[model samples]
Target: MIGDMHPGDILGEYHEEVIQLYGLGPRKVLVTEREAPYPDGRLIVSRTDTDGIITHVNRSFVEMSGYTEAELVGAPHSILRHPDMPRAAFKDLWETIEAGKIWQGYVKNLRKDGGFYWVKATVIPNVRNGEIVGYTSVRRKPDRRKVEECIPLYASMKAKEEEEVAQ
Candidate 1:
Protein backbone atom coordinates (compact mmCIF):
# COMPACT_ATOMS: atom_id res chain seq x y z
CA MET A 1 0.00 0.00 0.00
CA ILE A 2 2.87 2.35 0.77
CA GLY A 3 4.30 1.56 -2.68
CA ASP A 4 1.22 3.10 -4.23
CA MET A 5 2.29 6.55 -3.14
CA HIS A 6 4.40 8.97 -5.17
CA PRO A 7 6.78 11.59 -3.86
CA GLY A 8 5.15 14.95 -3.07
CA ASP A 9 1.63 13.55 -3.35
CA ILE A 10 1.10 13.52 0.40
CA LEU A 11 2.78 16.86 0.96
CA GLY A 12 0.78 18.51 -1.80
CA GLU A 13 -2.48 17.29 -0.34
CA TYR A 14 -1.56 18.48 3.14
CA HIS A 15 -0.54 21.86 1.77
CA GLU A 16 -3.93 22.28 0.18
CA GLU A 17 -5.85 21.29 3.30
CA VAL A 18 -3.67 23.39 5.55
CA ILE A 19 -3.94 26.44 3.35
CA GLN A 20 -7.69 26.05 3.21
CA LEU A 21 -8.04 25.56 6.96
CA TYR A 22 -5.67 28.19 8.31
CA GLY A 23 -5.20 30.41 5.25
CA LEU A 24 -1.55 29.24 5.24
CA GLY A 25 0.61 27.00 7.43
CA PRO A 26 -0.59 25.40 10.66
CA ARG A 27 -2.54 27.41 13.21
CA LYS A 28 0.36 26.77 15.58
CA VAL A 29 3.42 24.61 15.22
CA LEU A 30 3.29 21.58 17.48
CA VAL A 31 7.04 21.00 17.72
CA THR A 32 9.09 24.16 17.76
CA GLU A 33 12.83 24.85 17.98
CA ARG A 34 12.43 26.08 21.56
CA GLU A 35 11.21 22.65 22.60
CA ALA A 36 13.77 20.54 20.75
CA PRO A 37 17.54 20.36 21.16
CA TYR A 38 18.59 20.01 17.51
CA PRO A 39 18.04 23.05 15.34
CA ASP A 40 20.40 22.22 12.50
CA GLY A 41 19.18 21.54 8.96
CA ARG A 42 15.50 21.12 9.83
CA LEU A 43 15.25 18.33 12.36
CA ILE A 44 12.70 15.69 11.44
CA VAL A 45 10.46 14.58 14.27
CA SER A 46 7.72 11.98 14.69
CA ARG A 47 5.61 10.57 17.51
CA THR A 48 4.41 7.00 17.67
CA ASP A 49 2.59 4.83 20.13
CA THR A 50 4.18 1.85 21.80
CA ASP A 51 2.81 -0.24 18.95
CA GLY A 52 4.65 2.00 16.46
CA ILE A 53 1.56 3.68 15.06
CA ILE A 54 2.49 7.18 13.97
CA THR A 55 0.51 9.83 15.84
CA HIS A 56 2.20 13.05 14.82
CA VAL A 57 4.91 14.22 12.46
CA ASN A 58 6.51 17.61 11.96
CA ARG A 59 6.92 19.48 8.66
CA SER A 60 10.50 18.30 8.31
CA PHE A 61 9.45 14.70 8.78
CA VAL A 62 6.83 15.07 6.07
CA GLU A 63 9.29 16.71 3.67
CA MET A 64 11.96 14.11 4.23
CA SER A 65 9.74 11.01 4.18
CA GLY A 66 7.77 12.33 1.21
CA TYR A 67 4.52 11.62 3.01
CA THR A 68 1.78 14.05 3.95
CA GLU A 69 0.49 14.47 7.48
CA ALA A 70 -2.75 12.70 6.60
CA GLU A 71 -0.95 9.67 5.22
CA LEU A 72 1.58 9.51 8.00
CA VAL A 73 -0.86 9.90 10.88
CA GLY A 74 -2.17 6.57 12.12
CA ALA A 75 0.23 4.66 9.88
CA PRO A 76 2.90 2.35 11.19
CA HIS A 77 6.30 3.96 11.69
CA SER A 78 7.66 1.21 9.46
CA ILE A 79 6.06 2.88 6.44
CA LEU A 80 9.47 4.37 5.76
CA ARG A 81 11.38 1.25 6.66
CA HIS A 82 14.13 0.13 4.34
CA PRO A 83 14.23 -3.59 3.56
CA ASP A 84 17.98 -3.77 4.03
CA MET A 85 17.75 -2.64 7.64
CA PRO A 86 18.30 -5.37 10.17
CA ARG A 87 15.55 -6.53 12.50
CA ALA A 88 18.06 -7.06 15.26
CA ALA A 89 18.86 -3.37 15.28
CA PHE A 90 15.23 -2.53 15.82
CA LYS A 91 15.05 -5.15 18.52
CA ASP A 92 17.92 -3.50 20.28
CA LEU A 93 16.31 -0.10 19.89
CA TRP A 94 13.10 -1.40 21.37
CA GLU A 95 14.92 -2.95 24.26
CA THR A 96 16.67 0.30 25.01
CA ILE A 97 13.48 2.30 25.02
CA GLU A 98 11.54 -0.25 27.01
CA ALA A 99 14.23 -0.06 29.62
CA GLY A 100 13.35 3.62 30.14
CA LYS A 101 16.29 5.01 28.20
CA ILE A 102 16.91 6.54 24.82
CA TRP A 103 18.21 4.81 21.73
CA GLN A 104 20.61 6.53 19.37
CA GLY A 105 21.76 5.06 16.09
CA TYR A 106 21.94 5.38 12.33
CA VAL A 107 19.04 4.31 10.18
CA LYS A 108 18.51 3.58 6.49
CA ASN A 109 15.07 4.54 5.27
CA LEU A 110 13.38 3.82 1.95
CA ARG A 111 11.74 6.61 0.06
CA LYS A 112 8.54 6.28 -1.92
CA ASP A 113 10.62 5.74 -5.05
CA GLY A 114 12.53 2.87 -3.45
CA GLY A 115 15.60 5.04 -3.12
CA PHE A 116 17.31 5.00 0.27
CA TYR A 117 18.83 7.57 2.59
CA TRP A 118 20.61 7.51 5.92
CA VAL A 119 19.82 9.35 9.13
CA LYS A 120 21.22 9.68 12.60
CA ALA A 121 18.21 8.99 14.80
CA THR A 122 17.51 9.48 18.48
CA VAL A 123 14.45 7.67 19.80
CA ILE A 124 13.12 8.45 23.25
CA PRO A 125 10.37 6.87 25.21
CA ASN A 126 7.52 9.13 26.19
CA VAL A 127 6.72 8.55 29.78
CA ARG A 128 3.95 9.89 31.98
CA ASN A 129 4.01 9.51 35.76
CA GLY A 130 6.59 6.71 35.56
CA GLU A 131 4.72 4.78 32.87
CA ILE A 132 5.66 4.52 29.20
CA VAL A 133 3.07 6.03 26.91
CA GLY A 134 4.61 6.28 23.42
CA TYR A 135 7.78 7.24 21.59
CA THR A 136 9.30 10.30 19.98
CA SER A 137 12.06 10.32 17.40
CA VAL A 138 14.31 13.01 16.00
CA ARG A 139 16.41 12.38 12.93
CA ARG A 140 18.95 14.19 10.82
CA LYS A 141 21.37 13.44 8.01
CA PRO A 142 24.11 11.07 9.09
CA ASP A 143 27.83 10.96 8.35
CA ARG A 144 28.55 9.00 5.17
CA ARG A 145 31.47 6.94 6.52
CA LYS A 146 29.50 5.88 9.58
CA VAL A 147 26.64 4.77 7.40
CA GLU A 148 28.95 2.79 5.11
CA GLU A 149 30.45 0.97 8.05
CA CYS A 150 27.03 0.18 9.48
CA ILE A 151 25.39 -1.23 6.36
CA PRO A 152 27.30 -4.51 6.14
CA LEU A 153 27.01 -5.08 9.85
CA TYR A 154 23.26 -4.42 9.65
CA ALA A 155 22.88 -6.90 6.78
CA SER A 156 24.59 -9.63 8.74
CA MET A 157 22.53 -8.87 11.81
CA LYS A 158 19.35 -8.93 9.76
CA ALA A 159 20.27 -12.33 8.39
CA LYS A 160 20.95 -13.63 11.84
CA GLU A 161 17.71 -12.25 13.30
CA GLU A 162 15.70 -13.67 10.44
CA GLU A 163 17.30 -17.07 10.92
CA GLU A 164 16.52 -16.97 14.61
CA VAL A 165 12.96 -15.82 14.07
CA ALA A 166 12.38 -18.50 11.47
CA GLN A 167 13.25 -21.17 13.98
Candidate 2:
Protein backbone atom coordinates (compact mmCIF):
# COMPACT_ATOMS: atom_id res chain seq x y z
CA MET A 1 0.00 0.00 0.00
CA ILE A 2 1.13 3.53 -0.72
CA GLY A 3 1.44 5.89 2.23
CA ASP A 4 0.30 9.49 2.32
CA MET A 5 3.25 11.84 2.52
CA HIS A 6 3.82 15.54 1.87
CA PRO A 7 4.20 16.64 -1.76
CA GLY A 8 7.42 18.46 -0.98
CA ASP A 9 8.95 15.28 0.34
CA ILE A 10 8.15 13.51 -2.92
CA LEU A 11 8.52 16.24 -5.48
CA GLY A 12 11.74 17.73 -4.15
CA GLU A 13 13.77 19.15 -7.07
CA TYR A 14 11.31 17.86 -9.66
CA HIS A 15 8.64 20.27 -8.40
CA GLU A 16 9.81 23.15 -10.54
CA GLU A 17 10.08 21.03 -13.67
CA VAL A 18 6.69 19.49 -13.13
CA ILE A 19 5.12 22.92 -12.86
CA GLN A 20 6.80 24.13 -15.99
CA LEU A 21 5.90 21.03 -17.96
CA TYR A 22 2.31 20.77 -16.82
CA GLY A 23 1.44 24.43 -16.11
CA LEU A 24 3.49 26.58 -18.49
CA GLY A 25 2.13 24.84 -21.56
CA PRO A 26 -0.96 26.01 -23.38
CA ARG A 27 -4.26 25.03 -21.85
CA LYS A 28 -4.87 22.70 -24.76
CA VAL A 29 -1.71 21.14 -26.03
CA LEU A 30 -2.79 19.05 -28.96
CA VAL A 31 0.14 16.84 -29.64
CA THR A 32 -1.38 14.27 -31.95
CA GLU A 33 -4.69 12.79 -33.00
CA ARG A 34 -3.28 9.33 -32.63
CA GLU A 35 -4.61 7.15 -29.86
CA ALA A 36 -2.38 5.10 -27.58
CA PRO A 37 -2.32 1.38 -28.20
CA TYR A 38 -3.03 -1.11 -25.45
CA PRO A 39 -3.91 -4.76 -25.15
CA ASP A 40 -7.31 -6.02 -24.06
CA GLY A 41 -8.11 -7.76 -20.74
CA ARG A 42 -5.89 -5.27 -18.92
CA LEU A 43 -6.76 -2.97 -16.06
CA ILE A 44 -4.90 0.13 -14.94
CA VAL A 45 -4.85 0.80 -11.23
CA SER A 46 -3.39 3.53 -9.06
CA ARG A 47 -3.70 5.06 -5.61
CA THR A 48 -3.22 8.60 -4.46
CA ASP A 49 -3.14 10.40 -1.16
CA THR A 50 -5.68 12.94 0.07
CA ASP A 51 -3.80 15.59 -1.86
CA GLY A 52 -3.84 13.46 -5.02
CA ILE A 53 -0.21 12.45 -5.07
CA ILE A 54 0.46 8.97 -6.44
CA THR A 55 1.33 6.35 -3.87
CA HIS A 56 1.05 3.13 -5.84
CA VAL A 57 0.39 1.83 -9.32
CA ASN A 58 0.02 -1.56 -10.97
CA ARG A 59 2.17 -2.83 -13.84
CA SER A 60 -0.59 -2.20 -16.33
CA PHE A 61 -0.91 1.33 -15.10
CA VAL A 62 2.82 1.90 -15.48
CA GLU A 63 2.85 0.41 -18.96
CA MET A 64 -0.16 2.37 -20.10
CA SER A 65 1.09 5.64 -18.61
CA GLY A 66 4.55 5.26 -20.23
CA TYR A 67 6.14 6.20 -16.93
CA THR A 68 8.28 4.10 -14.64
CA GLU A 69 7.22 3.27 -11.12
CA ALA A 70 10.02 5.35 -9.66
CA GLU A 71 8.98 8.37 -11.72
CA LEU A 72 5.33 8.12 -10.77
CA VAL A 73 5.28 6.89 -7.18
CA GLY A 74 5.75 10.37 -5.72
CA ALA A 75 4.24 12.63 -8.33
CA PRO A 76 0.89 14.34 -8.32
CA HIS A 77 -1.69 12.30 -10.17
CA SER A 78 -2.27 15.40 -12.30
CA ILE A 79 0.94 14.62 -14.13
CA LEU A 80 -1.14 12.38 -16.33
CA ARG A 81 -3.68 15.08 -17.13
CA HIS A 82 -4.02 15.48 -20.87
CA PRO A 83 -4.46 18.97 -22.18
CA ASP A 84 -7.37 17.82 -24.33
CA MET A 85 -9.26 16.93 -21.17
CA PRO A 86 -11.76 19.57 -20.09
CA ARG A 87 -11.27 21.35 -16.81
CA ALA A 88 -14.96 20.95 -16.10
CA ALA A 89 -14.60 17.19 -16.18
CA PHE A 90 -11.95 17.34 -13.49
CA LYS A 91 -14.03 19.78 -11.51
CA ASP A 92 -16.89 17.31 -11.56
CA LEU A 93 -14.55 14.51 -10.52
CA TRP A 94 -13.22 16.37 -7.50
CA GLU A 95 -16.65 17.48 -6.45
CA THR A 96 -17.99 13.94 -6.61
CA ILE A 97 -15.12 12.23 -4.83
CA GLU A 98 -14.83 14.90 -2.17
CA ALA A 99 -18.48 14.28 -1.46
CA GLY A 100 -17.58 10.65 -0.77
CA LYS A 101 -19.14 9.39 -3.97
CA ILE A 102 -17.64 7.45 -6.85
CA TRP A 103 -16.99 9.41 -10.00
CA GLN A 104 -17.22 7.44 -13.20
CA GLY A 105 -16.24 9.16 -16.42
CA TYR A 106 -14.25 8.96 -19.61
CA VAL A 107 -10.79 10.42 -19.20
CA LYS A 108 -8.12 11.35 -21.71
CA ASN A 109 -4.61 11.08 -20.33
CA LEU A 110 -1.23 12.13 -21.70
CA ARG A 111 1.66 9.76 -22.09
CA LYS A 112 5.27 10.49 -21.31
CA ASP A 113 6.02 10.80 -24.99
CA GLY A 114 3.26 13.39 -25.39
CA GLY A 115 0.82 10.88 -26.83
CA PHE A 116 -2.71 10.39 -25.51
CA TYR A 117 -5.01 7.61 -24.38
CA TRP A 118 -8.64 7.36 -23.33
CA VAL A 119 -9.91 5.38 -20.39
CA LYS A 120 -13.22 4.64 -18.73
CA ALA A 121 -12.23 5.62 -15.23
CA THR A 122 -13.88 5.11 -11.86
CA VAL A 123 -12.38 6.96 -8.94
CA ILE A 124 -13.35 5.94 -5.44
CA PRO A 125 -12.61 7.48 -2.08
CA ASN A 126 -10.46 5.29 0.18
CA VAL A 127 -11.91 5.54 3.61
CA ARG A 128 -10.43 4.17 6.80
CA ASN A 129 -11.40 4.68 10.41
CA GLY A 130 -14.32 6.80 9.34
CA GLU A 131 -11.99 9.22 7.64
CA ILE A 132 -11.16 9.69 3.98
CA VAL A 133 -7.55 8.68 3.53
CA GLY A 134 -7.08 9.10 -0.18
CA TYR A 135 -8.37 7.71 -3.45
CA THR A 136 -8.05 4.64 -5.65
CA SER A 137 -8.67 4.89 -9.34
CA VAL A 138 -9.23 1.96 -11.67
CA ARG A 139 -9.28 2.45 -15.39
CA ARG A 140 -10.14 0.21 -18.30
CA LYS A 141 -10.28 0.52 -22.01
CA PRO A 142 -13.16 2.78 -22.92
CA ASP A 143 -15.58 1.60 -25.52
CA ARG A 144 -14.73 3.11 -28.87
CA ARG A 145 -18.27 4.24 -29.35
CA LYS A 146 -18.34 5.89 -25.93
CA VAL A 147 -15.05 7.59 -26.63
CA GLU A 148 -16.35 8.84 -29.92
CA GLU A 149 -19.41 10.25 -28.20
CA CYS A 150 -17.30 11.94 -25.52
CA ILE A 151 -14.98 13.61 -28.01
CA PRO A 152 -17.40 16.29 -29.07
CA LEU A 153 -18.75 16.75 -25.55
CA TYR A 154 -15.29 17.17 -24.13
CA ALA A 155 -14.37 19.55 -26.91
CA SER A 156 -17.37 21.69 -26.09
CA MET A 157 -16.50 21.69 -22.42
CA LYS A 158 -12.93 22.69 -23.20
CA ALA A 159 -14.19 25.54 -25.31
CA LYS A 160 -16.35 26.70 -22.45
CA GLU A 161 -13.43 26.55 -20.04
CA GLU A 162 -11.34 28.62 -22.42
CA GLU A 163 -14.13 31.12 -22.80
CA GLU A 164 -14.46 31.48 -19.04
CA VAL A 165 -10.72 31.83 -18.57
CA ALA A 166 -10.50 34.50 -21.25
CA GLN A 167 -13.28 36.60 -19.81
TM-score of each: 0.72, 0.82
Off by over 4 Å in 2: 1-30
RMSD of each: 11.6, 7.5
lDDT of 1 by residue, 19-84 (tens): 011112222111111111223577789999987889999998876665679988987777776656
Error of 2 at 30 (Å): 7.5
In model 2, what lDDT does residue 32 have? 43
Question: Would you give me the overall lDDT of model 1?
Answer: 0.68
lDDT value, residue 91 of candidate 1: 77
